[model samples]
Target: MKKQRPPGLIAIVAYKAFVASLLTVTSIALLFALKNHKILENFSESYLLETKLKIIELLLDKFLIVKPKTLLFSGLAAGFYAGLTAVEALGLWYQKGWATILVLVLVGISIPPEIYELFQGLTLLKLAVFIANLAVLWYLLHHLPKHGKAD
Candidate 1:
């Protein structure tokens, strides 16, 4: 990684890592979705399906369809968002002034939805995400250059 200035270096790196992680996870999910399709299709018509379904039902009550097309679409959608995140992360990491504002604006936009989700259910994950976004928003506002200060 290239050298980064202090102040928000850690935050910027964390953001970059977060985006990179999403890229890796989504990429792997895409592969898993596509590769497991055949095995799932074969097992669906075999005795293995009965045993697997029993075990799965016991573990989780959720229903899942392992169709390649659906998986492909999901992966593509995730990858698309991940790509955008990557670009923003790169910009932020480099400390481009514009990137900070861009990220600030984006995070500010996301806060409303996060607040809504928190309202829907006060889960730990939702709270953490909201707080994290709030922190990012605060950090950006506090650190980013204001008005004509940008040069």
Candidate 2:
């Protein structure tokens, strides 16, 4: 008989999968935006004029200045990250030992940068991400030994 996966592990897998899905969408959007830059710019301008929303104006202002090379790089990078995250999710779902280590190392390395970002400018989104990563790290560390014994 197969063992049931722990709820925490399931949650982690779900989280990774969700992140991968979001990144994939973002990657596609960026690439599309890059290809249709002029159309996007015209649409944004008309949308801004119609809505007159400060937030949209602010965001579009910054977005308009992005170079094509930067867009290409950002899209490619996001795609790569999405692929990596999907692999992590699948590996964890199958309870692969190397996946655990991969996650541990990736999450561990991110902590310092997260801290730096928080210190640079604290935000609710950043705080939540930092806490979530910490929780994942703690859960894996706590459960690793038991997980190994099961193998």
The candidate scoring highest on TM-score is: 2
| lDDT score, candidate 1, position 146 | 38
Q: Measured by C-alpha RMSD in angstroms, how accurate is candidate 1? A: 4.1
In candidate 2, what are the lDDT values of residues 1-151, reduced to their tens digit?
9989999999999999999999999999999989998876887778445767777777777888998889999999999999999998998898888889889999999999999999999999999999999999999999986543333
- By lDDT, who's the top model here? 2
TM-score list, all predictions? 0.72, 0.88
Local distance difference test, candidate 2: 0.89
Give the clashing residue pairs of candidate 2, or none: none
Error of 2 at 98 (Å): 0.8
User: Which residue pairs collide, candidate 1?
Assistant: none
lDDT score for residue 15 of model 1: 66
lDDT of 1 by residue, 1-151 (tens): 9554665656755865696687869867776757776655555556655666777554322224545677777777778777766766777666777777777777888899888888998999889878877887887788776311243
